[model samples]
Target: MDISLWDQLQSMDKPQTTLNNSVDRVSDEAIERYARSKWLRHKVDDYIKDDKFRRKSVEAFHADLQKLSNNDAKSLLHVSNILDNRSLENIGLDSGDYRNLLITYLQSRQDPLSTYRELILYKIHNVLPEEYLGWFKDDLRCSLFLAYLVKDSIFINAYKGREELISVVTDYLRYEIHMFIEEYTQNLPAYKVDYKGVGEHKTVDILYAKSVYLKNRSKEKDLKWLDSSNQHQIDWTYNYLNEEKRSYIILEDIFFPQTKEEKYELIIASLDILSNVEGTDVESLAILKKRKGDTKIISRGNSERIDVIQRMKKAWVQLGTDTKNSKDKLVLNITNKNKEKLVALAKNVNQTPNKFINQAIEDVHREVFKIDG
Candidate 1:
């Protein structure tokens, strides 16, 4: 994948970031006037690159943003595209040139309010957390980052705006913490899956062993990003986890189910592996108990649990079924025997039934609609 706009900025050496304590020092009226002029593009590059300018501009934007009602803030942040066609004409442009082009597009517009709104977006893009910069591709992350900046300040809970912001922020943190926990849990011996070998069975597969070792090494590198001094991020994570008696296992947001029943199925599928851990117990597993009261899932025999859990985790990570993407559900009516075979085949390859079926359909479609190269 191509490096995103914000990720490029984050790669800079000693790009200074500071909280502007006073908004009055940064003049929004003057910015708007300059932005309205045609000559604005000439100064855009210098202003954006200057750390002091960005700090003051961001502070002024922060003040302006809080004054608006929730609906207005939402509207201002809802941009159709980050860069216009003219700005994107040269894909080979370096990060600095790209940033210059984007700011020029934002300020080149005729409507001052529209230009200001675009500029606020530009400011937010500049101030994103460096640790999670790569994950800033979506609007959800952008909104969450903005909320983190201003969440402590007053917002009308009567409008449910504050409540909504907190809910989303918590949900995001839940998934983040869950990944942290996975780093340890995935290394447990009980989590290992018995692979259905192609050629011959062996006591140990050298390649698989090496892969596991490499994976653990990568996890150690990822853990370094988890060490953060940002108080807002630390507080949000601590408060959310503390709210529950036992920590709730939140599915990654992309793969989170739309219905309660699907969520229950996912939790049930994961429990057999979770339960085998040495210190795990009913009191320790809050989400499973809440979703399904049956204690049997926890104590169930490890007959096929490893395969199920592996398949679920792989499918969950592979699928990006966010509501933002348009999709159509296909209902297939098949005989029981065929369905059993399908399920068995999917499990062997560590895929969900839906994903397996979709892949099969796509394979056939590509063959039927073959194009000569």
Candidate 2:
């Protein structure tokens, strides 16, 4: 609902009260007045939780409120929770800037098409698995702002002479928004809570959000909140599994315990959502985020590699392509000293006794792979 006329009026009038005495929040009176409108109620609920529209950003919010005196401003203020103190502080939040933002948000909200567009984009921001956010945020943000600009110029105050131009702007905004949504949040469920009687708050979940997938040249995907399932695996799927469009995938668990379960549920959901896949094939394709100690090893870099091929890469480069700094060893003393392995190597390689013997001595040079300061 485009800030109701009443909401616009209420926004102009700042309630003498504040949110938990910290941020600007909808006052009880305003809540009571607009209680009948479930949409506005939900908007208020979103505002309360929106750290960006947190009480601290109220100064910026207040600028918007100031535009339309106590009544109009109050209504907007009731709905103006667009940012919180943290974002405000981080971005050097000032009432003046927030006032401008209010104008921005309100201008976007004025039209039905733009309002839905903003809401859908907001949903995309929240919906895409957090793992993809860091790589895609700039694209998403720029898409959002550009969409807003197009709407602001072409539709909000549209004129006749620019009909063709408006159509082009409209087409571009539509195409961009569609692409942004498709790239990140596509083929997945909405970022919403269906309320199956579960409540969780991982004050620590945010800490685990930053993630990177190994094995593939793919970029790191930010692991979001701990689902009742695998966030890590969901992240893995986004960066590695999904991109390949692979028919099957195996994900190893990193954060065990709670995250393990969450990762599992998420991968299962993606499997179900991505295709008509079912039964053991679907089940088998997805990696069962296990609790074994080995699962956590994915997060660690080198030092743990033990594959024969991999070992050669790091430990015995001479066996592969790193034979540069080796020294020819001294001749092996074989007159009387008993050597069973040398005898076996000579027989296996089918080389002369002296040649095999010389090779063994050369191997002892222990080729140096790194240079010292």
Candidate 3:
């Protein structure tokens, strides 16, 4: 069985040694050619040959490596080994070019841990070029870094002068948070079919009630772009968790339905009541024009009229029945203060103002236009 170079590199205790062995097997001419490259020679003399600088750099690198998660540490080691094994002919470039290639590779991979390390190096030691800043700007890694900062701001304390960096990157962080909330909510199960015979109605109802409460709370709060502050991030996280919890509860309710059909019927009936109330409003009559159809009135040129008709249609559909056509039509123009009173009445009944007015009209029609069946 042939193991790939990457697997071997991952398993090896001393990856650098393994890479050096591979280099040794290559022709000395290739090695001498690489050694004589002016860019490589100058880099080695300026940085690698300086004992104090070299020692400090190594120490810093190892210290940072220790701070990474296990998987991240392993990935960084593998990438380092790959760079170390690049031959003069394979790389065919100067030291600065090689460095650029390495940085590009790390950023393209969007390896958060590696990018964070590069950020530390560039911002603190000045070993890397300013162009390497792109690593921190990448969307996914930037969110990861923001998460880290939220967890422990001390990690980047060395670059206190660059607070502007957080401001620049936090938009992506907000976008990520939005996406997470949407994804979590959308994936929740909408109905449950498994608890037909079991006594799960109460459990399901409790869960759904809790979910509805949390979802309503989230709706009440502003969910748009937030300021790039630790407090804002923390608030966003709390809201996100509430959204997630709500979704989970909804999923549970869906997977264990109890009298769901009856519940739906009650909901539809309540909505029908609200719709009837809206239909009787003077505003509704004023906005609707006489039409030759079973629905009686058609919306005039007003967009609000059209919207109301659409909502009425939806409510009728939910009621599982159609309304009778009325040939008679009436138009009324009420005072603005009366309309405000109508709105207040609707709110008190947990219905739209238009809906309450329509229901009142229906009540008056029944009393005035009584016809024996």
RMSD of each: 24.6, 18.3, 23.8
> Backbone clashes per model, in order?
0, 38, 12
Model 2 off-target regions past 4 Å? Answer: 1-96, 101-349, 352-373
Candidate number achieving the greatest lDDT relative to the actual structure:
1
- Candidate 1 per-residue lDDT, tens place, 1-373, comes to 8763333333444324433433223334434433224333334444545555433433343444344433223222322233332221333334344434444443444432345544454433322221332232233323333232223332223212323443444333222222322232222223222232232112122223223322221123322322234444334333333245623232223233333433332233223223332223435344333433233334433323333344444543444364225366545698999999999999999999889989888888888899333
lDDT for residue 325 in candidate 2, whole number 0-100 = 33
Give the total clashing residue pairs for model 3.
Answer: 12
Give per-residue lDDT, candidate 3, residue 149.
Answer: 24
Q: List where candidate 3 sits over 4 angstroms from the true fold.
A: 1-126, 129-131, 138-150, 153-364, 371-373
Worst 10 residues of 3 by lDDT: 248-257
Model 2, 86-197: lDDT tens digits are: 2222122433554455455654443322342343334333322223233323332122222232332323432222232333333333223333333321112111111112
TM-score of each: 0.21, 0.22, 0.18
State the lDDT of candidate 3 residue by residue for 86-197, as single tens digits.
Answer: 3223232333444444434443443323343343332222121223224344432232223232322222322211233343334222222223332322222121111212
lDDT of each: 0.37, 0.34, 0.34
Order of the predicted models by TM-score, top scorer first: 2, 1, 3
Candidate 3 lands at a TM-score of 0.18
